[model samples]
Target: MSSTRTGLLLVCLAGVLWGTGGLALEILRDHSPLSVLMVSAYRMLVAALALLVASVVLRRGPRLLALVRAYPGRSVAVGLGTAAYQALYFGSVTTAGVTVATVVSLGLAPVLLAVVDLVRARHRTVTRGTLRLALVLGAALSGLVLVSAASGSGAAVGTRPVVGLLLAVACGCVYAATTALGSTVLTSADADPLALTTVATTAGAVGLVPVALVGGGPFVTSDPVALGTLGYLGLFTMALAYGLFYTGLRTTRSGAAVVATLLEPVTAAVAAAVVLGERLGLAGVIGSVLILTAVAGLDEPGA
Candidate 1:
């Protein structure tokens, strides 16, 4: 397969993996006394440790260190950005419903990124192709609204929606900025493919140290379910997910990359239906189609 296609597939899979995060984190919180910040701290710490082990096993530690030393600013920005956006997202999930939080934060990112893409290609902004791309984004966003509406049935739906919406918007903006910049710096020909993620996650884990101390929760869980959930979150959603995202960014446009990850909310909605016994009514079905269609539309040359 073409590298671009490979990148898209990898990013989409990352989105799917990320979709499970909110639910898993929520479950962990219920069983443990971990605060949002604490959980985020654990997440980054675990992801960093896992990547460190991978680097040791692969023997790329020295090269990655060189990359970090070579571009300290980029490394630190991406790392802190990762932690900030995640903590903000978790906060949004707490105040707003998960479905709503997911929709707002993830949905806003693609729109912001598309704007950047258009500016970068200003000469093409008035073309017919550009109009079609706009329509596709509109459809996808509309579908997301439907999905969000369909996904809200749990106790966490709306304790403080306004606060959640604000937090989510902040998360989206931070994430969009990170993706735009990260795509440029996270992939390098000489550095290990995992270099950027490893560095960023390690920094992020360190950045969250104060959070871990302030939030105060046991890192050691006796419950197997909580332990497994933590592993899934740290490994699948974070370490592996980000590795795939940046790798995909090597070939995919930032705008298309974020949009492809729109699958996240849909995946979350489905997980809700299956695990939480929530209903996916007609709106959910229609929204899913629209999102999938929009993602496919982006593959066209003009888009």
Candidate 2:
């Protein structure tokens, strides 16, 4: 198979792995004392630790440290964004159903990125494509409003639907910011994606430690299920999925990779419906469709 096709498959696998994240968090909420913030912290910590161990085993410790020293500011920014993304996303899932949280957070990021790019390129001549982009943004916003305003009987336990939607939007914004910032570092001639990810993940864990301490109580859990779930989250969702995504990006067009990542929300929605019994109302479903459509449309070939 062509490298591009292999990259597509890898990205799709990453998305599917990400789709399971919300459900896993939900399971932890039921079986463990860890709050959303604590879960986020632990996930980052474990992933970072795993990466560190691997770097040592592969004799890349010096190279990883050099990368961190070379791009301190970018590394910190990426870490902050990563922490914000995880905290907001997990909070959304805790308050909203998996379907809503996944759709809003994952769906909004690409549109946000496209808008940022357009603003940055304001000096360029406006064209029909620019107008189309505006239309897509409008549709996305309208959909967001619909989803946020939706009220029905299908909400998850303790669902604060509106708040959840807002958190999801915030998650998307953070995700977009981090992606843009990380891209700048990743595109450098001598960039090592794995080392970069390790630094960011480790920094994120350190940054969130205080929040987890202050906001989350009974942080230690002896539940085997919870412990295992957290391990799965760190190892599979954050570490493995991120590794696959960066590796795939080496061979795939950025736009194509973005489109392939849309599988995340689709898989999340299906899993929520089948495994978690979280149903979406008509308005919520419509909003999800609009958001996904806009995000996909905003992704251009070379993006």
Candidate 3:
């Protein structure tokens, strides 16, 4: 496969791992007393530790340290961005319905990144290709709204309605910013993707420590299943998924990268149907197809 195809596959694989992570989180929630914040903290902490160990074993510890020293601000920004998106996403889901939160965050993020790219281009003007890309993204987002709204079973909306929209938008912005900054750090600092992932994830873990402690300590549970799921999330979802994501970002545009990751929600929807025995309604099926089509369209040259 070509380098571009390799990048696309890496991103798609990351999305799939993320879907499994969502499933693991749902299972953990049902099986334990851990709150979402606690699970997030544990996932980050464990993933960070695992990546740190890997870096040392692979003899990338010095490189990691060099990146940290050279791009301290970028490292902090990436970590904070990760924490911000996660917190904001949860807040949006709580404040709005899951359907609204999912659609708004997932749909807006790629658009935001695309806009950022347009703004950053010094000489490249928005051309026919940009317009076409916009239309594809719009179609995908509409389908996402249909799928997400119809998939839910009438959850209660929070009293403060506008807060949810704001949170979701913020989540999208943070996602875009972090993605662009992450790519910059990777290229400018010539950092190892896995080591950078460790640093950024560790920062996120540290940021969430306060919330995790206040929410409740002992994030780990005695249940074997829950422990196993947590390990999967840390090792596979965070460590492996983010590593691939960063690696792909080396060869992919940030906007295109976000578009590729839209597969994450699609994967989750399919996993829910197959693993949890939930049925995908007609809209859900159509929505999944539209998203896949949009991602596929992105594979064309110059897309």
Candidate 4:
């Protein structure tokens, strides 16, 4: 198979794995959101350990460590941003409904990142095509609003308070900023994607420790289902999915990679429908289509 096709396949698989975490999270809803956050934190720590071991075994230790040492500042910043994103996102969902938090956070992230990119491009002139891409992204933002409105009646829609919704938006902005900064730093360093992921995950896991502490009680695994859910999320969603995504990007064209990652929201939506029995109204369906269309329109041909 062609490298591009292989890359696309990897990305799709990554999305599937990533999507599975929501199901896991649903299964673990018995626990407090903070407890769940702790589970996620531990998962990151485990993933980092696993990746570190793998790197050594594969004789990539020097390279991985070198990358970590070289970009210590950028790596830590990205990792902290990632950790903050998770904390705020969980808090949002806890206070607000999942629908509200998810829409506000995930939907706004790309828009913010695109704006950042545009601002950076001001040092250089943006082409007409880039401007068109911006417009398409704007449409995607509109679609997110429509989707949120359509799905607003669900329990997860207003579960959290207004403050939670605001926090979720803040989470989105932080996530966007970290992602943009990470991309720039990684590109500049020619960092190994897996190694980069390992560093960021380590940083995020460390950052979560204090939050988990304050919100903490003894770690209790009273239920087998909860344990299983946590396992799935930590291993598959947080670790493996990210690994596949970065590796896939190495092979895929940049445009194709972005398009593939855009599948994340669609995957989440479908998972919600199937696992949570959350029905998407006609408006929601229309909004989903619009989002896909907008993403496709924004992806530059040679990106």
User: What is the C-alpha lDDT profile of model 1 across 1-303, one tens digit per residue?
Assistant: 788888888888888888898679768867776566776777888899999999999998897889888888987788999898988887898788777777888889999998998888875438877887798789889888888777764445768989999999999999999998788785544555498899999999998867768666564566777777888889989999999988888888898999888888889888878887778899998998899898888777778
Where is model 4 poorest over a 10-residue stretch in terms of lDDT?
253-262
**Poorly placed runs, candidate 4 (over 4 Å):** 1-16, 30-34, 123-127, 149-152, 156-162, 248-262
Candidate 4 to truth, TM:
0.82
What lDDT is reached at residue 6 by model 3?
85
Span of 10 residues, lowest total lDDT, candidate 3: 150-159
lDDT-better candidate, 1 vs 4: 1
Query: What's the lDDT for all of these models?
Result: 0.84, 0.73, 0.83, 0.70
Best by the TM-score measure:
3
Candidate 3, 1-303: lDDT as tens digits: 788878888988898898776778889888888888888888888898899899989999898898889998898789879987988988898888787788888888888887776676642777777777777787678777766865665557766669998998889888888999998988775788887798899899889867778876665689988988889998999899999999998888888888888888788778888898877788888888888888887787756
lDDT-wise, the better of 3 and 4 is: 3
Q: Which regions of candidate 3 deviate over 4 angstroms?
A: 122-126
- How well does model 1 score by local distance difference test? 0.84
What does candidate 4 score in Cα RMSD to the true structure?
A: 3.5
Residue 43 miss distance in model 4 (angstroms): 3.0
Each candidate structure's TM-score, on Cα atoms with residue i matched to residue i, is 0.92, 0.75, 0.94, 0.82
